[model samples]
Target: MRTAYCVDTVRAAERDLMARLPEGALMQRAAAGLAAACADLVGRVYGRRVVLLVGSGDNGGDALYAGARLARRGAGVTAVQLAPGRTHAGGLAALRRAGGRTVAPEDAAGPIRRADLVLDGIVGIGGRGGLREDAARLAALADGSRAAVVAVDLPSGVEADTGEVRGAAVRADLTVTFGTHKPGLLVDPAREYAGSVRLVDIGLDLPGEPDLEALQHADVTRLLPVPGAESDKYRRGVVGIAAGSARYPGAAVLAVAGALRGGAGAVRYVGPAGHAVLARYPETLVSDQGPERAGRVQAWVVGPGAGDDAGTVAQVLASDVPVLIDADGLRLADVGAVRGRTAPTLMTPHAGEAAALLGVSREEVEAGRLAAVRELAGRYGAAVLLKGATTVVAGAGGGGVVRVNPTGTAWLATAGSGDVLSGLSGSLLAAGLSAVDAGSVGAYLHGLAGRFAAVGAPVGAHEVAEAVAGAWRDVVRG
Candidate 1:
């Protein structure tokens, strides 16, 4: 699993490491790695034009030292000084000694326009809100340029802790982060700004639990439920899906389709769309009765196209088994009842739904997804899966490390896709994973399946659901 630490944790680690190391040793190590990464990106660095946006922080020092290394290797490197007087004096002198020239911010446009590469060292990890007016202009110029932009640490103008890009920010083709991955580098919209991150370890040992964790293939494989030879249908666990309405029967079919492939022993579906579900998947245990009378099920998936079905939602929520609430069920479910449940509860909401639940605008949720997910989880006393560009799962009571799903394709954005996710996660819940694990693992598989199904083309939600088994097999094989 990939883990990310908050700024305070990272700073503490860095300070401790720096104290133990010789003066300037840590910076040199960082500079060397930065230079090496830059060399690899700008292949055949000799005679290439390199522009470094130097500021008044350690990030500027890193860029200057790296620029000096590049200059020694025949690149015509130039530093654009954002704060001339306050720049790292030693780094500036070192760059000058290595034949790098310096340019004022006012004189940077011409060089930036013709540069082969741009290093964004304008701000460090501690920078809050957005860039200053002068720095914003430089960021704008960098965006307008054709050069492959590489951000030092993280992209400038992003909230290091929250992943919120309030104002002008640098957009990099790659980001070379030091020590550990920052929470901003893993969460969006800061994640979006930091394209293709490359971690250049500076050897700081971070302590305690991470702010966020992202599951890899190995981790997901370990968590995947595999039945033994003696396992039976009931033993494997049954998932009950209480979804769909008379108006949207496809939601029921799609949900059942996902549940069937979700490693559950059996699927029991009870809703108005029983006929549609049975027509598509006869293996499903269909019922006309309410969720309370649907017999035994290890887990229940409520909502999807459950239009105005508050009664069923309440019935499912009252069950002692773990429950997953999604789509229309999210709307009908009671907060107090959800909080009072003794069993694990997982709530999956897109940015819009999350916004509504939080009594905020959709823009607020999308802009600060990490905060939104954590907040919702705390409010409901349930695990929250906030679905979007970067799907994040926060555990109940709001304070555990949030799990971020790294695998996904933009093509996964389609109708009924979330309904499929609800079923898949519900099945995992029945299979005995914790609410957070079920949500994260289900998201991982769902994302991989979307990638496999799309393969650069548009894909239907049903197609994504069909590809889950393939995703599962791939994980196991790896």
Candidate 2:
């Protein structure tokens, strides 16, 4: 897992390291990494024009020292000091010693435009809001220029802790962060501003659970449910699905389509469209009495095309198994009953449904996705997966870090795809994974499946479901 700790955690780690090592060692390490990355950007740093937008903090110090390295390597480096008097004295002297020149903010535009690379060092973790007037002006100038922008630590004006951009922020082509990853680099708003992120290890040795994590292929493989030699149909897991209706039998088929591929031992279907589900998947055990009467299951996937049947929803919630609520289930849910359930509940809400549940506009939820997901988790006391271009899964109790699904594609937004995801996640939940892991792993598999099924073209929901085995195989292979 690629873990991201909050800014405060990063700071604490850095402070502990700083106390153990010699003074300014961490800063030197950060500068060396920054300079190396810049050198790679401009092949043969010799004679390349580099501009540093220096601010008043250590972030600016890092840029100044990096510019000094570039200057020593025969690059023509100019430091545009935004806060002349407040700039790091040692950094300025080092740059001057290394044959770097300084230019006033008023005289920076021409050089910034003509430069081959720009280093944005306007603000770091200490910054609260957007850039100051002078910093914002320089950022705007840099944005308009053709220079390849590299932000040190983070982009100027972005909230390092929350990934929230209060106002205008620098849009970096690459961000070279120090110590560990920050939340701003993973979540949206600020994440949109951060282009491709590169982490430079400064040996902070951070301990404890991360504030956020993005699962890589290896992490997903470990979390995935794989059958053992001694496993049987009942021993693996049984997923019960309460979905579909007489009006929309396809929903039932699609939900079962996903459930069958979920690594579950068996699937039990209970709904009005049991005949259609049975026709599609002969392995499914059908029942018309409802979810409670459908007998035992390791997990329950409720909603999909459940329509307005509150009785079925109530019965499903009554079960003491892990429950995944999606589609129509989200619409017909009794909030109090869902909260009062004994089993772990996971709600998968698209932006529209999330907005309705939160009593806000859809645009509001989309704009601040991190906040919205956390708010839902806190309110419902359940694991909440807010699906979109960027899927965020927030766990209950407000302690664990929210997970951001990075493997998402625009193609996965097709019809009935979510039903497949609900089944897949429900399967994982039944397989004994925690609700957060189940939701995140399900997204990972669904995205990989969509990509495999699409293959540069459109694909139907059944094809996506069929491709799950291949996706799982590929993940396991890696």
Candidate 2 structure quality by residue, lDDT tens digits, 176-294: 99988888888887888889888999999898998889998999988888889999988889999999988878888998888888888999999989888887899899998888788
> What TM-score against the true fold does each predicted structure earn?
0.99, 0.94
> Which ten contiguous residues of candidate 2 have the minimum total lDDT?
396-405
lDDT of 1 at 42: 86
What are the candidates' C-alpha RMSDs? 0.7, 2.0
- Backbone clash tally (model 1): 0
User: Number of backbone collisions per candidate, in order?
Assistant: 0, 0
Candidate 1: tens digits of C-alpha lDDT, residues 359-412: 999999999999999999999999999999999999998897999999999999
* Model 2, TM vs. native: 0.94
After aligning candidate 2 to the native by TM-score, how far in Å is the CA of 186 from where it should be?
0.9
lDDT of each: 0.94, 0.89
